[model samples]
Target: MWLKRFGGGCSREKLRSILETPDGELIIVGGKSHGNNQYKCTFEFYDDAWILKVDADNGAKIWEKTYGGRNYEHFEDIVKNPNGGYYAIGTACNKKNPPWGGDYCAKNKSALWMKFDDSGNSLGKKHFTNGPNQTGFSITNTSSGGTAWVGESKKLVGSKWQYKAIFYKLTGTKVNYSKVVDLGGWNATSIELTKDGGFIIAAGKNVFKTDSDMKIPALEK
Candidate 1:
């Protein structure tokens, strides 16, 4: 095998999510690879959510900020909200708790939702436990204020394995979580608000709508 090494300059792979601002600035969030992956099983390794302002002209980095705990944080997606600010969905594990604490770890994984202001400062961060593995897929703004996140919840029921499409909505400064919507065996992957003020959530093998009530229809491949 041919081995390649960097003399002195070295950079690791990064997972990135991007959002376009109203003024056309691009906002990127992802984790910076901490040198080599060798330190993971030993030292604390983190893939933080970092913001980068890139020049749309030459695709050069203008500004960037890294946000996360001393754990694994990877942003799956980013969205620009109607009220400004940006929302990100991802998973983090082995982290601290409360005002951003907790190793909400499970099977070596944890579900995470992190929000940031226009300036890249973290507005709020929350973690959810779903047995071992869980991840946040998408986020959308709610007309009623606050935001909504959809993802899959993997857990167990007796001796059987169960997967659920879960929804969580947060409101106010306290960010009180609303009751989760169980899509029964469905896995929610993407969420959007329909024109009628209803929510259209695409769950595995199914698409659903909820407007004070819930109804699901099979989505054909």
Candidate 2:
């Protein structure tokens, strides 16, 4: 048995997802507290998303990088891109913090998707903002050679606000389709492409199945 840890310099870090490479390496993604890498003294780091690559044998570090915006931004899921590079999904906030009061910076947040190269260099990015609310919680590659992402979005209906499970797909920077599923939950944590050219998602206590276009049947909806 073996155990390892990282970010000893930071005050704290929270891991979100981990993926294994075909050649036996590991890709780990998470959020870390903001601070100087040389010293973990204060909270200036501002909560940013970070990725780390390590050897599968002894857990030795290969490379590490961080992605951040004006405020809170973090990765919730990651998936491999069929064309090349990798896709990462998370929540990005553009709001600035109050100088006197400690605000959560939850408002004005939107779903963020980014593409990175093999060495963790960013290539492109996209944001999905529906009614000014959506978070990127899960990502996967579809059968049509495009990337798909799912998450929870706060949508306003006729009178009241409702929580919606959002799904979207795109190739490169062009979005081909989008769908919203009422999964009776807060968010979808995982998703996978099925053999029948559909999608199977895990959300709350229910498993939702959808067609190629991400439309669920009446029985499943």
Candidate 3:
């Protein structure tokens, strides 16, 4: 067996997800630290979202790219688009403003989506912020030639705050907020597309199925 090292010489680097291209190439998405090695005690760190393409057979690096602002950026999941490209979803903490343009810094830690061509060239990006602390955890290619993502975010309900599972459908940067299911303070970790074009969400100790519209249909403990 052969092993490969990426983002070498960095104080910290993490591989979050991997996807295989139609041409037998492997795409790795994660976060990597660069420049100063100084660490911080806060949640936001000095990191960037990193995408690496490698030869699947020989495990040799073909190309690598990084995207971020002055603060932190992370990629949690990736999927190949139907148009011979790739989409990566994650969270970003831009210091000045949100990448997609917003006035609040608390919304800086918003859901991020990036599109890249087959050659590892970036196409565009989109950011979503409903409330603070939104993070995209999983993404999948939808049957309608679009994409779907699932994450968790904090939202204010009446006088209290709660965490909710958020889902989104995207078509070329246009995001349709699918559903915001109240998680009762639990966290939504991942999502999968079912054969019937529905979705199965894994939240805390429960796994539930939702219809195509992201409406809860059933639950499994």
Q: Rate the local accuracy (lDDT) of all candidates.
A: 0.62, 0.74, 0.77
Which model scores highest in lDDT?
Answer: 3
- lDDT for 211 in candidate 2 is 84
Candidate 1's residue-wise lDDT over 75-175, tens digit each? Answer: 76787767768878777763344222233244355667777777767888877765566777777776676667778777666877577776666663344
Those runs of model 2 whose alpha carbons end farther than 4 Å from true positions after fitting are 8-12, 35-45, 96-102, 155-162, 219-221
Model 1 residue 24 distance off true place after TM-score fit, in angstroms: 0.8
Q: Rank the candidates by lDDT, best first.
A: 3, 2, 1
| RMSD for each of the candidates | 6.9, 4.0, 4.6
Candidates sorted by TM-score, descending order?
Answer: 3, 2, 1
Over the stretch 87-146, how does candidate 3's per-residue lDDT look in tens digits?
A: 999988745544322332444478889999998788999888767668899998776777
TM-score quality measure for candidate 3: 0.83
Better by lDDT, candidate 3 or 1: 3
Q: Itemize residue pairs with steric clashes in candidate 3.
A: none
Steric collisions counted per model: 5, 2, 0
Cα deviation in Å at residue 21, candidate 1?
Answer: 0.3
Error of model 2, residue 60, in angstroms = 0.8
Residue 4 in model 3: lDDT = 85
